[model samples]
Target: MTVDRRPGGVLELRGVAGGYGGATVVRDLDLTVGSGEALAVLGASGSGKTTVLRMIAGLHPVSAGRILVDGRRVDPLPAQHRGIGLVPQQGALFPHLSVAKNVGFGLVPVDPLARWRSRRERAARVREVLDLVGLADRADDRPSRLSGGQQQRVALARALAPGSGLILLDEPFSALDAALRGRVRAEVSALLAESGATSVLVTHDRA
Candidate 1:
C-alpha cells in the first residue's frame, strides 16, 4: 500500500511483525495514521490489538519491518526519543500529583530555559488541553477526587500536553460506563482533530 505523507502524519507501520518471544500475534500489519486522523485498530480479544499499540509505544520490539514517525524510522530509536504519547487503559495518573501536575509531568526534567518553556506557558498549555477534554476546572483536584471518566480525560490531557504528534491509546475508554463511552469517544475525537494529532485507538469491538 502507498503510504501518504502529510505534514502532521505522525505514525506509520510497514510490514510490522511482532509478538511475544515464541508466538507471533501480529504479522505484516501495514497501517498508516494520517495527520489529524483517528484510526481504530479493531480486533477481538487476543487478536493482537494491544500488542500493536505496545509495539508502537516501544514497549514491545518488532521482529521485522519498521515504525516511522514524521518520516523518520523509529524502530531503532528509544521510546523517549520517538516523541510518541501513550494513554493506557488504566489512566496511570500519579496519585500524588494534582491534576495539573500530572498533565504537565512530561514537561518536567527539561532544562528550565532550554527545551522547557516558562511555568506559566506550561500551565497555560496544560489548561488549554484540559479544557479541551473538559477538565480545566479540575486542575487542582487530585486523581482520587475525580470519577473514572474524569480520570480518563486527565490521562488524555496529560498525553496531549507534551505536544506529541501521535498518541497511541490502548483501550483507554474501556473502564467507563457504557452510557459514557460515546461521550468520551466524541470528546477525544474532537480534541485530537483540533490538535492535529494522528492517533491510533485500539478497541475490541468491531462495531
Candidate 2:
C-alpha cells in the first residue's frame, strides 16, 4: 500500500482504501501532490471525494494503504500531529470566538506545553495569515457578521496559520453565491500558490 518517491512533493497516497464501515468507498487510490501544487478531485455526489480527503487529513481512519507527507509515513500519526490544513465545506469557525481568535486557534495551543507561543508571537502569526487571506480588516468581527466567502477565507487562513505542509479543501466555496464562489475560489487558488502550499482540493463543480 506504500511506495517511496523522489524528495519533492509534500503528499503522497498509495493504494488507499476505506469507507464508513466494512464497505469500501475509495479503493486502491494513488496520488501525489508536489510542493506548491494544487490538485483537484472532481466527482459527483457520493463519489468518495470527501472520504479521500478525510483519509488524507487523518480525520477518518484508513483501513488500508499508506499516507505520506514530506516523504515520511504519517498513517500512524494523529490528525493534529500530521500538520494538515483541512478546510471543510462548512467553514467550521468557532461561533464563540472572534475571527482573529478563530484563525489563531491552532497556532498556539493544540498542545499547550509542547508548542506554546508568546501572546505577541501568536498575534503576529494570526495577523500574517489573516492578511494573507485578505481578512485583516475583519479580524475583530465575529463569524456571524461575515459573508459566506469571507468566512471561508477565515477558515482557510486558520488552516494556513500553522504553516502546514498540505492543505485539504473539501468544497470550501460551495455555499457561496455564483459570483462570490468564483471570486473566492480564485482568491484561494492564488493564496495557495503564493504560499507555496501543496494542496488537494475536492469539489463536485468542474468549474
Backbone collisions counted per model: 0, 0
Q: List the residue pairs that clash in candidate 1.
A: none
Candidate 2 C-alpha RMSD relative to the actual structure: 5.6
Candidate 1: segments with Cα more than 4 A from true spot: 1-7, 109-114
lDDT of 2 by residue, 1-207 (tens): 111112224799999999975888999998888887899999999999999999888889999999999889998889988888898898999999999999989876667664436888788878888877788999999999998988998998888877776889999988888988899888889888777778899999999
Q: Model 1 misses residue 17 by how many Å?
A: 0.9
Candidates' C-alpha lDDT: 0.82, 0.85
lDDT of 1 by residue, 1-207 (tens): 111122345578999999886899989989877777789988888989999998888888999999998789998876776778899998999999999999999876444443337788677778778877877789999999998878888988887777777888989888888888888877778777766778999998554
* Candidate 2 wrong stretches, greater than 4 Å: 1-9, 111-116
Q: How accurate is candidate 1 locally (lDDT)?
A: 0.82
Model 1 vs truth, CA RMSD: 5.1
Error of 2 at 86 (Å): 0.8
Residue 203's lDDT within candidate 2 is 93
State every prediction's TM-score relative to the real structure. 0.89, 0.91
